[model samples]
Target chain A: MIRYSRRAVLKASAAFAGASTFAIPSIVHGESDRIRVGHLTPLTGFLGALGTYATLGMKLAVEEINQAGGIMGRQLDVMSEDSVNPATAATKAQRMLEQDGATVLLGEINSASALTVMQVAARNKKLFMQTGARSDALRGKNCNKYTFHTDIPNTVMVNAVGQSLLRDNMVKDKKFYTLTADYIFGHDLLAAAKRFFGANQGNLIGDELIATDVTDFSPYLLKIRQAKPDVVCSNLAGNQVTTLIKQYSEFGLPYPIVGFNLNTADAWAAGDGNLSGTWPTVWYHTLDVPASKAFVAGFLKKYGKPPENHAWIEYVAFKMMAQAMTDTKSTDTDKLIAYFEKETEFDILKARKAHFRAWDHQLMQEAYPFTVRPKGQANDQWDFIALGTAVPKAGEPLEQLAPTQEQNPCSL
Target chain B: MQFGFLLEQVVNGLVLGGYYLLISLGLSLIFSVGGIVNLAHGAFYALGAYGCVEITKYLGFGPAVVLSPIAVALLGILFERFILRRFYTADPILSLLVTFGLAMVAEQAIRIVWGAAPLSASIPPAFRGSVFLGDFLFSRYRLLILAVVAAVLLGVWLLLHKTSFGCVVRAGIQKPDMVAALGIRLQPYMTSIVMLGVGMAALGGAFFAPITIVHPAMGAEIITVAFVVVVIGGLGSFWGVVIAALLVGVVRGITIHFAPAAGEASIYVLMFLVLLVRPRGLLGERIEKFE
Candidate 1:
């Protein structure tokens, strides 16, 4: 029989607790030896589907970087989780930097969540690679020195699709009714759309602000019928966009539908025959660029599916971060931020290299307008989108599609 | 012209309400009979959507919608036999917790099976597009859904009011002790009620899959509304649930017309107002077991 005095048990328990307390810092120290990147994206909710692809793309990037001996010969450690909502995202971002020794932060598709995370990163003075959020306000008035945005903003998306609409003579004098998602992202997109409409002489007939969780668009559709607009524009985001697309097709309204923002995953979820009109995308799997093709092939081999646009952006964002770290040879926030602010061009699996605009820290990259391929023309489920030529044409500057200094309120 | 638009919204809201009734009535029935809240009811709805989407690839939409709910009803048998049966006489919280856990497990299982991306399902070409009836425009597909819902409502109402099975179920809901004293075994009746409940939820999923995003969390999305409908309608009343579902839909539509940003929140506001006015629900009958 084993016996122990009460004092002896107490002393042993104290020592065990003391040991674990000491052990945690050492584990954190070891983790700090590597570049600890905290990644957050919505793994559940409306943006969850895109976040899944985002995580996969970031994982593939991390794997490739580690295989090539990692950034500056230290392995990269990524702690990824669901950024659930704006409040939770801020909480997790703070915890990642303060407690987990994460030197940098990355990943968020929801613009609202990204804004919260950006605030966290700024407070901690850590670099946040705002990978997939497209709200213009993040780059405009809300822009900060610590956060750099990679995806095309609302302005770029509107321009990308707007140019196509203009070429087809669909914007000028057109009676446009818009359905905007009721969130920071949707509101920002609607603002940008309004700017485009005002500049192009498009008549704004009516608009509705739709809540994010709305699954049924029947009532809204009835209103659209009542308005009888010449063009129906969607400023909705995530799964809501897919829902609207599906229901819109079901109603089969006479007016053509177009969107300022549409992720490839959302479009794919709208299915083959349902999607019509034009939409702007950051990147698609079917790009003719060699690097993109390679990335797509590698992704297909690993996951048995083509990578969505969120996945592609996360992949390039990580690679961009790795390049910045390698160039500067330090994870120091100032050095990394300085390196990016210098406008060092990066190959983002596109025809032209993309660079972060110095003032706004928004990535100046080519965006594309896409329409669904004709029925029976698509080779596979993911091959439905017919990607348009890169906007800003060959001779035009990439910044032509992005917001100008006067238009963007960013002062940083 | 403004009145015409409001009228269009009202009629459309009614059609949407009919769809909501399909899922909520089943939830009400299962709760009425078993004294279990069946938080996993939405999971069955999600499963029905997934099942229908999968079946549609092989069997076409018409057959898939029919087979998917029937398939889910079979699953309800297993659910009742293994999980739900043990909780019927237990504490309500225990059943709630068990069903809640089951809902998560079902959602995760679906994620594993279908992947996280939503599977696209479109309305059949023949049924796609709008039909004009005087000044009102209606989606042809939604009208078909309304017809199906009407038929199901009639069938369920007739089964409950005009049949011997319904008599025993009604008696079992009110006094399981009395039913047992009368030498009637309520276990089989409980199982049938659960099957019917989950099956109807699945049917709602199968019909809505074409118009809504068919994703894993879809069940979680719907369960809240189903609960709202059930609570607002009063827990054990069939007509109460029917009225509440339609009321919720109409209220949401009218609210969206007036205040677009508050569209989703309108249903909860409606639920809150109804509960404030009638604590027992609009038509909720008191069941002895629940009391």
Candidate 2:
């Protein structure tokens, strides 16, 4: 399968040998004749680290693109907005379009906010590259021609996790129990997990939502005793994930606890080997590629610390957008869309192995299925890396996954 | 639940309840003498945990466990003089904000002192593992926690209810002018109460350090529960606080055994329901009426 995908990519790249043929169209409106991009980020939130990285990634890509002869002699200019909330993201999206006259909108780190930004793109006819947000619905019924996802959506994670579980023979005869965060990420992950397990060989016997009612894990600990499910899939974040793991250990609750949304730097360090062996799906692990390796080394050299998921995703998404702008050969919306479709392969450290999917406009790159097992750097929760398997290029048919109406009742 | 399981659940409830009683005992005592809410009560908890880490890192586990709270209380006096005194004359909400600020300051200070990662703490070498209790089993660490909390609660009960200083504090809460008229300076008593409440919160945090995480934000998460116990048991009622603690703990224990998803919300819900029926609370003999 890997060889086949590699050969197919080689053939396609050979077919489009002259990569510079698609240069940004000349600026007629007395503009700088450069590609102007907008970044929507959350400077303050639980996912703040990721938002910062998303912005930085765009900066790095723009810098690299401009340095390498300015994208057919037209440099990439970019600006970002702090899309910390829905209203702010909507405002930022509009400002990026009308005020800044941004040619493209880089999706926010938060999925709910990304969806809100997608609406703006559809109306304004601006290209949207979604890199961070993992909403499965964005590629489904909510799919618009203008919106493109560069990161693996939550459902893709489910497919990767489920497929890997099946491959490892780890999904049989187990009763799954979900300890999920009560939000879009949690709900979507749980739904995708259920679908994945059902198709393979497992049953979601019992589940619980950790939200308003659960300030402590004392009750959930007791239910674990009562139900005694074979697997506990928890979608907890930050300190809460560490809290649950510690409490579970204290109670001596013995069961394989898989982390569904445990994909952050803080959780990795805080878990202290307790969350190790728990499986999770993520877009890029810093240990996977040379670009990532170099980026991590550079980041650590600059900041005296290692990079995590936030930095890795930002690095990939920004570069992809820059490459897209350069390939389109024009700042014009109609021309850019044609350019994006034609330039299927994105050359970057993150997605150099694979090409971008044209169907959902989601990145058709490989996902490194990581388990939160022990032994890594200190004081960080991003201890997870590619454990045993590199899930090969399996083209995720985004639209093939059920639409928003089919998935979310309220979305319809 | 089975017969053995029910007993185990009760035991668990008692252990969980003991922490509430232990922490609230100090808050109640402090409230009786000093009017401030001591919002940084959880900070004391975190301090205890950090003290355990620092002391344990330097000294052995045994010495650290004994010395951590003493170190915290000694430091607590300084905090009382520097931070808490200013808030005394301010609005009650000001005390709330100041203490909340103090809690934030302490969290960051501790993080600055002990990085963002959680450190490993264990039950003192003497009390590791579990003992068989019929069909159920109890961790020695948990059993040790029970003994410690019980001993502290009894010690507090004696110090407050059975002593002259306790008598003055009790009088101060009900009739502060009378205590002042009796020629006893209120500052020393207020300082002691502040230290005592903070010390208890620290002890709970220290004991939990091995079992729960020893990070900065933990105190923020559990402070609401501490407040729940304070409100439900009546603002200044000692015995009321004790009963309320047990009720809250047992309810959590029982519910977790049944519906774990609602573990956190259950405590507040129960507190709300209690406040609705008995407007004063479980034991509010004479509260300053707000509503």
Candidate 3:
């Protein structure tokens, strides 16, 4: 065997490591002409199903934007990947900004993950158009200058459903037992729900904080039955909501189930006959607006299915980001933030155009409370829920349901 | 009144334990016979649920549940022949890595075929709702799962204890060299054991699909709990797995009743305590190969 000198070995290894560093940036930043945007969402775990839809929606928007000459004539190169969890999300966001050369960040359905991503964006001084995560805290206490939230927050969802409950006269003097997901998102929602109850005459007799991975809700169901509450409210998120709903139906508890949070994907996954009661949604494919109808038709044509709310939000967010880049003539984070801070309205396929609230950077838009259609009335599997009228009605300010500056601690 | 509610949780836990038994028994069996910790066991479980969902469209829920497990077991034949057969006498780490890779591949394969969204499944109308035995309420579907688990456990017990086939399998587990010296090939026995093991996991998946969210990662979610049961029951102890499974379920239910946040953590805690007391598990026996 031939042996080399120790100095030679060290020299060769150092050169190789140095070569790798040079090679990596060249490959990663190969397309200097294209504008890179980083997209992340939970493509695994409980929120994974919704994340899949979010990716699809982002893809569709990217395709459309490119076809329409892209953002400021530079084709967008969106690097979409699974956020996995909050810690992973933050790490990925940091890499996307620093290494991947992404000018802007987008996409997330999990609130906790979104918060971490927001922190990363703030640290990097990058723009993050948070697409689907709806925790009020993300907009309230955790809000940052670099992150703009698109989805309605937890308080909006609570008020949207709370309005329906009030109309049905179910809130006053009602004894409520709640099952909350044991996470930041769920805790925020539970706080919103408690606030709603406290404002109304509803009594929160019992509430259980459920671990995210707990598949069996039978024990929780038993506890609910024992409480004998007038209403059972769900503040659980992702597929946990579906599991809880299915098991709740399985137990056939007398108390009607309602929730402060329920994504369209989660609601659909509950199946037709099993789902009942009112729930809040950011958007539904069945919205009657012309642009909304066109988006749904196109999504159905391409995907062979209607777009979920997460999908709609991601699509709209990408479109708005593209518009921002076009109007501002740059992908610079500070410029984009300034443009959004001007509160320029963008058509989000809703009855009214939405704009970022200048103070908190929360998207001021319409939220809808939905209820399941009567059995056998649905045209197909996706058409099970009947969308209610948009909250705040036609003449009212879009921010009517959102938390005020007094309630929210956000300063940026 | 509090005691009555606690009793309800305990009873419910036992029923839940029965479901856990369906998954862990097969895991325990494969480990006993082949000494290969099948990390991809949960993949078969996920396949069972997906198979059941696919078949339910044409054949209804009753036929789907039965056919899904049978179909997955047929796949297990190939699994044993190609993958597991080679790794039996090799380094255990190799088998573990191969199976872990296979589990990821299976999850991705499922994601491709079924889409990333969870497939919707519902309990049959007859099996919906709860039944009250005195004051304690039982989900009608869970009771059906209990019956199926009991039947499966009994059938597996009779097959393992009474049959001549089991004798060779048992003999193979205890002394592989002796069995080879006696001119008996353990290959066929190993194949059957794997088939039965994965089939049981699939059966658990099929039954649980209605109650749980039927997603691609559901297999990964369940494998952890299944492994915990297998560990707590100890290696090579069928009765040990059964007792441990029920004990885990009861413990989880009780924990949820008292401390809802720690319901999922309670099982690992139980596993920790049991391992601390008896490292080999509650009923684990000493087999020559593992030692």
Candidate 4:
């Protein structure tokens, strides 16, 4: 007798249901007067903490916009879904488009999920403002007309951090040992960092690709000891940061450390004041900019803690999309895309003005390099990172932070 | 690699193998003695780790380490009594499904209580430094882990080989009807053994917590690897589990030194090779109940 697996049965049924539903026009379930924004982020997996903050950030933005008379005199309506994985993300994106009547789609933390969401957005001809997936490929080889990324790509992050490190005399003549997460994001980040290091005449002594679910870093730590590199660059993500930093400090390997991108949530998880080294982020709650100060105060008064980098990006992405729609007075995908590409000059909660680069629809915003606050200098538990270098010193001029035209030639 | 560095890698392998030994031992016991497939043993492990982290905040580290495993063991006792006991005489697949659901519940419960972000416990001040052993630097905490695991393994061996409880358990594994005919209450013995197995898993969690991050999904990560080890060590053999855990751990350690990318995949490769050679495992015993 042949037995079918539960997953296969469910997939078959979902395909049948989806095909049938696609034939019918979407019925708007939300308030007819409100403009619906479908917010899809990983709200329940390993990235759940960041995703929760992302949801809160978007909620705060929507409320502020609605209170201030939302775009084109319509209140913003949000339909949130947990983008669990790529397959589920694609399914949910289709559901949002065909059943929920979401006029705009945004918010995805995983790059793979964001790619799938981008595909759905392009297929439906809806405006998608991607919040936080750092793969440069989204703006490069996979560039689509309907999707716009508001987060810094991996190439930008690596270049920004690398330039800052070099200017600080940190990696000019030093040997570096790197432990990278073994996946698409990690591979992209490592490649970008290698390019930056190669340009700066730095030596890469050893590099190891670590598994995503690795709980032990001792083997890699031992190898680090033997290599005796002057600096250690960890290109790992999520809880890998916590495990590696804690174990690194415990092992007492005396090397200055840095990260390509480190989330503030991970810094908090590395409690007992174990968070060390310099890191770069698109935004942080402790930034000294006026807009950042306002966001931090508002988020703190409402949510009881400052917003993380992910939260900051989500908040900025929604506000940018909303402001663009208001300026153009149209929610048409072509109008929004043309408005952003040709005439959109927006405040990105930074000191300088940022705009969507025409070549690639990436939000060319300033990146912040932060150092872990010393134990005595920290004012509170979350005040763990402070600015390492002034803005625009390393991450500026849209052309410098991102890849050159020769490297990322796009036809859009 | 230099001799000293290679030796350090071996030591690392031993520490990792000791951990796999404790976790796989619990999986092996639940399958062998109770004839129940427990997929949630790793959840108990996570509970033990998170319990230790929370307890350390109120009590000191020593008391936290001691009480965490006991708390998890009590939870195991309750779980075995209420949920697992119902499926004891039922189809084994029922137990697998029940435990798998329990695992999901435990993971979500942990998320609600502890939050989804990964949390870590710092090493005790006493175990902070490294031991300089003539050209090699070994972490003192890892050495302590190795010693603690060795003692636990030795104690377990003595319990299984040199006691009347061991005889009853061994006899029950092969001939539960004979043990029942001899006027012994097998149900209580089975419950007690289940508690012991789960407690060992918790103990491993408590010890390994300082070295690793304590997250809700950490248990799920280890459970799959533990199941692989159990399968490769034979379904219900005690010695088979011990040997397989160490072998897998050392091989993984060496593989990381050579090819870091293949380190995780190498465990499955080893499992495949072992199954090809000995379908029942390295020290698999012929158990008529499972057949």
Candidate 5:
């Protein structure tokens, strides 16, 4: 072993101490070199298909932002964790804030987990961008000062579809047989559908709250056959959606189908092009806009498939956050929130710009009616659904699709 | 509800019962013959489904349907010789814990290989459309499921009751030491029984794969239902499991017609009621361990 002089030892110790002193704060606060973003989403489980796409969208945004000289000359770094459930989400949110020193938090497809993350964000005073959950409570009773919702909520989705139903002459005095999933998310969506149908003079002949695990939809299908409804409004989620669509097709029921919330991935999974219906969608891959085309190209280059709505929500969420941070020239949670509340517009790949409402922290974006092509008429595998312009007519104001200030009364 | 609808519900219940019968039969056999709670039974089912998917992609649906279960059964033999054989003499709880750990690893491995998204196999051309039976319409694929399961149940019965290998297996389950003292080795019989039980579970998975969503968590989803069927049927009794599975399927189907949300909940309620009345199960036999 070699022995060192006292002066050398002292100098070495000083250098080590100096290096650690500078490195520790950088890890916590993310100095001028990098900005830490904590991404909490389900990377595994039933909702994982959408979650994985959402993570990809986050990555795409982070890469583009870093390449374009990220917020205040600092690069963006995302630390992702699988938010499996509400309990896991709450603990991870706290750990992300305290242990990881994350300056911002994003993601959550499950509404219950989103609510938990929202509470954690409020308590920690960190800016949390809610990405995938579509519960109306997030914009109403559950809305908090710290959280900002980027996806379209249940009420907005219903209202958009309701308008389309009236315009397309599908809802006036029409009888509907509703098959709602038996869960909190399903209950909320059913409530929204009821409100829409009630307002539009639609009659519900049969209503069934189906358990999520119930694979065979035949019992309910037989009921629908007896009830003879005009259309069967499906408020189902997860694999339940695929099951219903497949079984319904197999049954050869003549009732027109309409879905409140249908993911792009669900359509793709219904192989042989079985899924077909007029659905209220937030965004489709086939939107004829520059941002959408560019996003589709870049996403295809990286992921080898067109981005789904979950991917769109996550990609748009990061871009919107980065825009706010750049505009304010700061990542301070309060300052950025204040800037967000001032009605800043974001180009979210739609024809019109989307912005956060001052009252509720909801993103006011364009909603469209999507119709899937028939199996015989399909061009490519992913070219299943196309945007319909009849219902939410071209150039229809986005404000009309969402609830007014009086309806929500959200006070942050 | 109309009488026609009620009749339709009965048919539906019977079809659902067929799946329960297929799944619980294998679990009951393994528990009784092997004396090890094979918690990885569902994982074997999942592997069978994934195997079917992979095999069908190249060999088409016909050959996949015939060969996937056999391939998974061979895998079960390897699993028994290497992993399960070590825990044979240990406490039953050790086997349960070990199988549970294996199940978790298998599910993760499936995710790593097949990805986390739900996948579905296209229904074969032969079973694509519906066939009308009298006034009611029924899925042709469902009819195929009922027929296959019925034949399988009959085959299992004949094998266990008529064959010499099955006789040795039964004797080993009841009196391993006595069977050994008779100048006969039971290790091969135990290995064969495990293979048969696991292969039966794989057949259930292979057939159900075309109808249901084949995902990673499918094993977790089916395991609880299998255990409940086993417990409610009186653990080791083969006919008890069959009767219980049928009862569960019919009750669930009927419950969906009356109260849609009560379909799954009613099964557990029935399980609880059965356990309360007879802790051993509906047809449970008092089991004696061979010293």
Candidate 6:
């Protein structure tokens, strides 16, 4: 599946990038002495804890690669900085690449922050193997050849779960109420839910978006309790997810809740069976197979805690970068990208086999549909067993949802 | 959407009002007597939450109880003489600014020392369930919180109105020259009053810490609502502030039920409307102008 003509793609100004032909620097073209990978994440603010966990995962991945004879004897020299804001991420991207000599940069959990870093990647000619952002626009129209997504995009995750429900007969004419965290992520996830539901047989009765900084959900829950839908879809993470599900259960809304992002293993860790029986669309989980189990076990053995879906993405990014480096047998940025596109079936952190789409640069991997179990049968972060479902090839010639890079100029 | 929704919103508003009342009472008391707003009041609340979390986390205490407020008050005394005494005679606004900076410094300090993330506080293991109302359910913890707040308010009122020290402080606020002429050193009393007010804020913070995260900006965010209560209640009028706190909370709560978008906005509207009604506020005493 790894096809390469090596013809240079058209280049645009900094105001726009239309899949430019990458010019490899003469220095690291054939040599494999050492490759520096840069990373940026928010280690402060409300989302700091999640950011730290993601950062630690990247560091651990770097360590594993270094231990195993390095990337062709050139270890990943880690250079990380805190992208606390758009301005900060932009600055860090410069320092990591320009000053620190990072060949490829990875790690940004926040999608808004990732778009900011994308500008830096375009300017510096470095590959940003985006690890944890889920915005759908990162691929397709907004996508650049220099940009390779490691995180599962929302459209991909939604489509996987949507199709699964259709095949499994889970998508019946069920009424849904959404308690979305009010933001771009929340809005897009809810919209996808509505689209998928419309595509399938599911019906959306009501939806509400909660502000990001809202400390309490009791007031909002009051309205939800009154409406009482069959299903409640939520888009929230970290402690907010923990607090909401706990309060939702307390309100005793007879509704069965299913959230795309909320029903992760991290939710269970923060909350004790608060989200049991909820189904979520996830990139990878341990329950699917042996690689996932080993990854989770290795993570727990080292970190002394279970690897949530976020951690799996970090592990995968590490493996992907290592694979691209191995196949090209060179550390040049352009050659590495060519090697990535040519990468047919690579070893991901979780599943034994994963394929990346040549058209969209989207990784075709398995998504999980987990049914949360009650208190008695809980296993660490997981509620119930997870079922494996395959995501379709990413670059479908269907209707494009997000404005592509050519349409939306990020620099301005 | 329904009549029940409005009814439920009112209930929700009351809960918010009650919480604000607890937080603002301390702020108002300190401002009238201490001549400072005590911005660090939110920190006390956060610390109270952290205390409860720590006690429960390490010691496995049932839940962080109202006893946290008492600890916060004592902590306030240490902060008072060292910090408040230095700025007693300065401009009132200067003191306010100082305290505001202190609040920021205190919050960051707390975050640096304790780590910036939300901490967990349980509904006292005993009262963790919910009580059914007509259509909605209310947690026993919230009811217990309201009850504790009431008791603290009563205790603060009793101490302020009943004690001779309270009389002297009240007299000093009314006529500082007379109190000073009578040979009472205002420094000790002013310092103690500042301590008392800060302690109350800390207590409020500690109680709320469980409900919210112990983040650095938390103090600044809630302070707006607390300030609104202070402004609408009339500066230096204790009861007026109390009533104002309740009114704002209820307004915010009900707004959530109905509009949800204008939860904080409705509070400002209520304040403007109240200012338009009675120039000094409902319970504010008229002052004789002095040059």
* DockQ for every prediction shown: 0.52, 0.16, 0.60, 0.53, 0.26, 0.21
lDDT of 1 at A250: 91
The candidate with the higher TM-score, 3 or 6, is: 3
Clashes of each: 0, 16, 0, 0, 0, 10
Could you tell me every candidate's TM-score relative to the true structure? 0.96, 0.79, 0.97, 0.93, 0.92, 0.80
For model 3, residues A136-235, the per-residue Cα lDDT tens digits are: 9999989999999999999999999999999999999999999999999999999999999999989999999988888889988999999999999999
TM-score of 2: 0.79
Which of 5 and 6 is the better model by DockQ? 5
Write one digit per residue (lDDT tens) for candidate 4, span B1-291: 477778888877877888888889878977888888899999999998898888998997789878988888888789889999888778787888899999999999998887777665788888986888888777888788788888888988888789998888888888888999999977787777788888888888888787777888888888988988898889667788888888888788788888888888898999999999999988888888988
Interface RMSD of each: 5.4, 12.6, 4.0, 3.3, 7.6, 11.5
What is candidate 3's DockQ? 0.60
Residue clash pairs of candidate 5: none
Q: Candidate 6 local accuracy as lDDT?
A: 0.67
lDDT (10s digit) by residue, model 5, range B133-199: 7778788888888999999999988888899977887787777789989989877776777788788
- Tell how far residue B154 is off in model 6, in angstroms: 2.2
Candidate 1 lDDT, tens digit per residue, B1-291? 999899888888999999899999999999888888989999999999999999999999999999999999999999999999888767787889899999999999998889888999988888999899887889999999999999999999898989999999988888889999999999998889888999999999999999999999999989999999999999778899999988999998998888887888888888889889998899998886677
- Name the regions of candidate 1 deviating beyond 4 angstroms: A1-27
Over the stretch A1-412, how does candidate 4's per-residue lDDT look in tens digits?
A: 2356899989999999999876645446436777888899987655666787788899899989999999999988888989998889989998887777788899998778899999999999998899888877888888898999888899888877777787788877789999998766788889888888888888899999987778878888988888889999999876788888888877878788889977778777777656677788888776778988999899989988788888888888889989888988988788989998894788878877789988788887788777777777878777768776544554436556778778885666
Worst 10 residues of 1 chain A by lDDT: A24-33
Model 1 steric clash pairs: none
Note the residue pairs that clash in candidate 6. A2-A342, A141-A404, A141-A405, A142-A404, A277-A372, B44-B202, B45-B205, B45-B206, B48-B206, B49-B206
Instruction: For candidate 2, give the docking quality class from DockQ.
Output: incorrect
Give per-residue CA lDDT, model 3, range B92-195, as digits (tens): 87899899999999999999999989899999989999898899898999989999999999999989889999888888878889999999999999999999
Task: Choose 2 or 5, whichever is better by TM-score.
Answer: 5
TM-score for model 1? 0.96
What fraction of the reference interface contacts is present in each model, in order? Answer: 0.82, 0.23, 0.80, 0.55, 0.37, 0.21
Instruction: Find the candidate with the highest DockQ and give its number.
Output: 3
